[model samples]
Target: MEEMECGIEKKAAAMAAAEEVGRKEEAAAGDVGLKELSRKLNDFAKARDWEQYHSPRNLLLAMIAEVGELSELFMWKGEVRKGLADWDEAEKEHLGEELADVLLYLVRLSDICGVDLGDAATRKIVKNAAKYPAPSKEGA
Candidate 1:
């Protein structure tokens, strides 16, 4: 009985450690922001001499194309749930890639246009909240 208790305790400890590591990884991933992604995109373009081709119009067009690709993935899928519960790994990965492509182009476009995308987005969110306030509990 003592040995069984020790084995269970070891399993619980291992599970707890795994959960802690997963949390730490999630926190680290959350640290990556638009600025870092923008910088990486800029460096990638510069290294390949593609910066000249990344004009605002060109980036915008590329982003739109990526959006089309992303939309195509859901075109026939009739309303997917929030968690994409039915998506296979390959489908989800493809969706992620298309989304990332759109974001990268948008970040690059914003950089070329001298716009701080993060700050602009933050201000837009504030404006939207002010423009469209939530209903009060009293009203409900």
Candidate 2:
């Protein structure tokens, strides 16, 4: 029991340290963009030699799993408001973590697939705007 407690402590310490490093990096970069996140994830995988398991399919599946976890948080909540005004701090933090997981996996997958996610998203937004243009005041 003592050994398990020590192991858990060590794991917690390691995670905290990693978070500190991420915070420092984000501070240094001035703004945390997808490219920075992708680079950080790449370095993280390389450090653990886990890149072998980060194939596109594996990343996609993992991302889907994270999405499922995120969905579970709102499963029976029945259309939460945009601000989540009723949620407590802990619940919001938990939601943030799950959302981060989904985003990190997606960024990593895009990196592996040689996709410029920001550029793609911008182009997609333009395409969507063209497809569904806002009604003019004259029409309304």
The clash count of every prediction, one per candidate, is 0, 0
For residues 1-140, what per-residue lDDT tens digits would candidate 2 score against the true structure?
Answer: 99999999999999999999988876786577898899889999999999999999999999999999999989999989998998899999999999999999999999999999999999999999999998889966
Candidate 2 deviation (Cα RMSD) = 5.9
Look at candidate 1 and give me any clashing residue pairs. Answer: none
lDDT of candidate 1 over 1-140, digit per residue (tens)? 99999999999999999999989867886587999988878899999999889888999999999999999999999999998999999999999889888888999899999999999999999999999998889966
Give the number of the best model, judged by lDDT: 2
- For model 1 the TM-score comes to 0.77
Which whole-number lDDT from 0 to 100 does residue 81 have in model 1?
96
